[model samples]
Target: MLALVLQELQKSKEPLSVAALSKKLNIDQSALEGMLDHWVRKKRLIENNAQGEMPANCAACSGHARSCHCSAQCPFIARMPKTYSIAAGERGTDND
Candidate 1:
């Protein structure tokens, strides 16, 4: 299962979401998360915040408001989920 996850990460050009991967790999998202965490510990995978950082000097941006910008009164916050990708120059082993 770990190997399969690694393979999927390797093939994807962009980071993948747990929900998408769960469907693709036929594994539960919770279980897949644990496996992804294992690879993160092994330094074979990296978790990234899909949402980019907010502007530094935005007076109202607390960086934790969960909204895109603090003062814009954005109708919806873009809640980007963490995505997983394989580490550069790392390869998965069949025995993993």
Candidate 2:
């Protein structure tokens, strides 16, 4: 089930909401939230504020809020590089 959800997220260009994901994948909301929270903690997924519920200054930028200048400078607007998950058995080479 996680694999299917990951695939859907990978195919999407924009951030997906929990409701949309749950409906599309036919999964329970609580279960999906738990999975998403796990990924967020693992740094495999990011949560974006949609309604300004969280203070803008408290937002994460590269895992730290201090790294960004926030409203005063707005220097943290650069796009983040795409992230991906690798299978557990994959071996790393020197080139990597």
Candidate 3:
């Protein structure tokens, strides 16, 4: 079942939301999130949220990124839907 998640992500032309993946795999969001977390920990999957940073002057931070507690899940802003992708460097070519 974990492998199936990787397969779906690998074959996708664009990022897929957790909600869409849950429906496609007939699994609940909670279970799907665990699997995604596993892959992310293994450095195979990149959660989109993990790659983003709030600018120091963004309204959410109010020009205080240095002191703001607005880590990835800042409540002042709405988060993007949960999504993951194979890390760029991990998608090795057969020739390599």
Q: What is the lDDT of residue 41 in candidate 3?
A: 93
Q: Mind giving the per-residue lDDT tens digits that candidate 3 earns over 1-96?
A: 999998888877666778988998999999999998999899988765433355433445533445446556765564456567777766564222
Clashing pairs in 2: none
Candidate 2 residue-wise lDDT, 1-96, digit = tens? 776767776656556777888888999989988887777666566665422433332434434543444645554555443233322222122213
If ranked by lDDT, best first, what sequence of candidates would result? Answer: 1, 3, 2
Model 1, 1-96: lDDT tens digits are 799999998877777879888999999988998999999999999776633465332334433444444456754445556678788677444313
List the pairs of residues colliding in candidate 1. Answer: none
For every candidate structure, what is the RMSD over all alpha carbons to the true structure, in angstroms? 7.8, 7.4, 7.0
Q: What TM-score number comes out for model 1?
A: 0.66
Off by over 4 Å in 1: 50-76, 91-96
Candidate ordering by TM-score (highest first): 1, 3, 2
Higher-scoring candidate on TM-score, 2 or 3:
3
Whichever of 1 and 3 has more lDDT, that candidate is 1
**TM-scores, one per candidate:** 0.66, 0.52, 0.63
